[model samples]
Target: MQKRILGVVGSPRKNGNTDILVSRVLAGASSVGALIKLIRLGDLDITECDGCHVCWQGEHCAKKDDMEELYREIIQSDGIVLGTPVYWYGPTALMKGFIDRLVFFNSPLHRGLIRGKSLMVVIPFEETDMNTVKPVIDFFDRCFTFLEMKLVEKLVVPGVSRKGEVVTKSEKWLREAFESGQKLGSGLT
Candidate 1:
């Protein structure tokens, strides 16, 4: 069966560094014949989790919005690439909100549904120091741990603040991102 990989972009900026990297990863995955889908959180009208606990009772969220569609896509996907720009030493608000809605899957009633899936995190930061991206990495690590997903890889690009800067500063990183996607698509990571 062909593997289905989903790329979720959390950056509000369209075609920004995060989006570009995620697109490159998906392109790599496509090269290896894996089916790919890219979803931009900024385009969706996802609301914050209201702590309604409805998912625990019904095995699904009660809110009627774009998240419902995302939930289905995530459940069907064999692998996921989460791309986000670092904001204030953490994931952007869009990323956090999307993750918060993932709480539905964390309920005991729905545990293990997403287990064994592969996950890759792509973070682009403006800071020259790599340490600035640590918190974002750690956040994803903990999240994948809880979801029982395999963290296949993490691609961090630093010192990219301006638009389209990634294309200029480091073509090497872009190549690496593509390679990582190929690995993920081939199930080698």
Candidate 2:
């Protein structure tokens, strides 16, 4: 069977730089014969994880919301591409919430569900320096490691503030994102 890749856009702004980058990545993945699905978290009604520890008991989350569907998709996917815009030197609130909910996959009972899966992170920030996105990178690094997932790639595009600005100002970054997706789809990373 073909590999399935899921791209999750965590930016609240529709058609923002993060979303454009993710769309390009998914397009590249599709070009390489990988099945691609893009999920815009901003459009979903995913609630915050209640810290109930119900999933630790081998039971599903107590809340009924869009997260349940996302959990299913994540489990079924071979790889995941997470894209977010840097806000206050960190990932947006939507991204943070999504990451928090991922605890279910890391629960003791489902410990290995995410093992061996691949992950790619794309972050866009207004800061001109690449260092500005370091915190976000570090966050994902630790999270992915905890999940026993492979951190395949990290693409950080700097100096993009306005919507659609990346398209004109950061063509190279866009190409890099596409190439990273191609590599992931080809299983070369």
User: Which digits, one per residue and each the tens of the lDDT, describe model 1 over residues 157-189?
Assistant: 999999879999989989999999999888887
Scored against the true structure, residue 151 in model 1 reaches a CA lDDT of 92
User: Number of the top candidate by lDDT?
Assistant: 1
Give the alpha carbon lDDT tens digit for every residue of 1-189 in model 2. Answer: 588999999999999999999988888888899999999999999999989989998668877999989988998888899999999989999999999999898887776778889999999989888778999999999998989999989988888999989999957988998999998887777
Clashes of 1: 0
Model 1 has an lDDT value of: 0.93
Q: After superposition, how far is residue 52 of candidate 1 from its true place, in Å?
A: 1.1
Worst 10 residues of 2 by lDDT: 105-114
Candidate 2 off by > 4 Å: none
